[model samples]
Target: MSPHHEPPLTRLAWIGMAGLALVLVAMSPVAGQVAANVAVPEPDGYRMENYRAPTPASLRGAQVVDTAQAHRLWNDKAAVFVDVMPRDVKPPNLPAGTIWRDKKREDVPGSVWLPNVGYGVLNAEMDSYFRRGLAGITEGRKDAPLVFYCKTDCWMSWNAAKRAMEYGYANITWYPGGSDGWAEAGLPLEVAKPVE
Candidate 1:
């Protein structure tokens, strides 16, 4: 009689092994948590704005106002609008629909074009300009209600807003939507003209 050896694995055994491995993976707490997180829907409106805890980013620390509310605030003359964009980001040189407006002409009708503090990390000249602009605004009314914003999710506005709050502005609203929100709402925006 010939010596018999075990048969090379059957197809059913392979299938069973795969299914068992899958079940074991699914039972893990890490897998469960990942599935739950994936199933959860993201927030629709701005909820992070009202958070009392320290925020990690720009709009996180400041009030997040909608375009409608911002428009109303502007109409009511309740806010002193300030744009925090660098000179390099404005329109004409950029697209007509570009968000960042630095120059006087590009500024919103009544909004002040104050370059953000710490423009160039290495250049002292740009730093000085930024400091002067910030100091000028914060000198007298450090507690003044000032609204500041840049591009959406862009840190320039967020950093600027945070700096403003640090400077003692009592009320600082960070428009997370920024210029995008303004244009999206069909709100009228004044274009800057060269003062010849």
Candidate 2:
């Protein structure tokens, strides 16, 4: 009831404003990403989502690498680079003069283009096929270094990496910086064709 004392409602209002300011300040670090063309790395303990790819729950066993590590693995003769980006079949109905180009299928040189490898809903047949293909690629060696990638923020590589880990592979690297990341680094890429 004193002139120096603020009313309870006014005090609450001030408290709310202070809380709001703190939240904005904390989020200011990423405000630029919303406006810029830069790729934003996922926060230390949060999921980064894209329209198509959802972030995985845990990457405990799978090591997430950037473009550099990817490059290193690319040179390793024993390392297997798996590009799990799904390939879309061209429509056969296009006119003779019309041109339809395939998706940017070029990957970091020596990468295996595994079309249809990133399906969220893999039936038993496809799942078995994936396991077999992975095994064959690594020559049935669980200790072989395997790198899985697709495109930037693609859940395909994440899923593939996790699947490989579950299959008991000791070293599985998830290159979250997929094809886009590779090309952005000005690294060499080779044209790839989908294997039926």
TM-score (all chains, Cα) for each model = 0.54, 0.67
Model 2 lDDT-worst window of ten: 42-51
RMSD of 2: 6.6
Model 2, global lDDT: 0.75
Runs in model 2 deviating more than 4 A are 1-30, 34-58, 90-104
Which one is best on lDDT? 2
Per-residue lDDT over 1-196 for candidate 2, one digit per residue giving the tens place of the 0 to 100 score: 7746988898899889999998897688577566444444433432223425445434778787878877877866657888888788688898899988887688878777777666655779778878888878888989888888888867777767767776799899888788888999998788897655
In order, the Cα lDDT scores of the candidates are: 0.59, 0.75
The residue pairs in collision within model 1 are 105-192
Q: State candidate 1's TM-score.
A: 0.54
Screening candidate 2 with a backbone cut-off below 3 angstroms (N, C-alpha, C), the clashing residue pairs are none
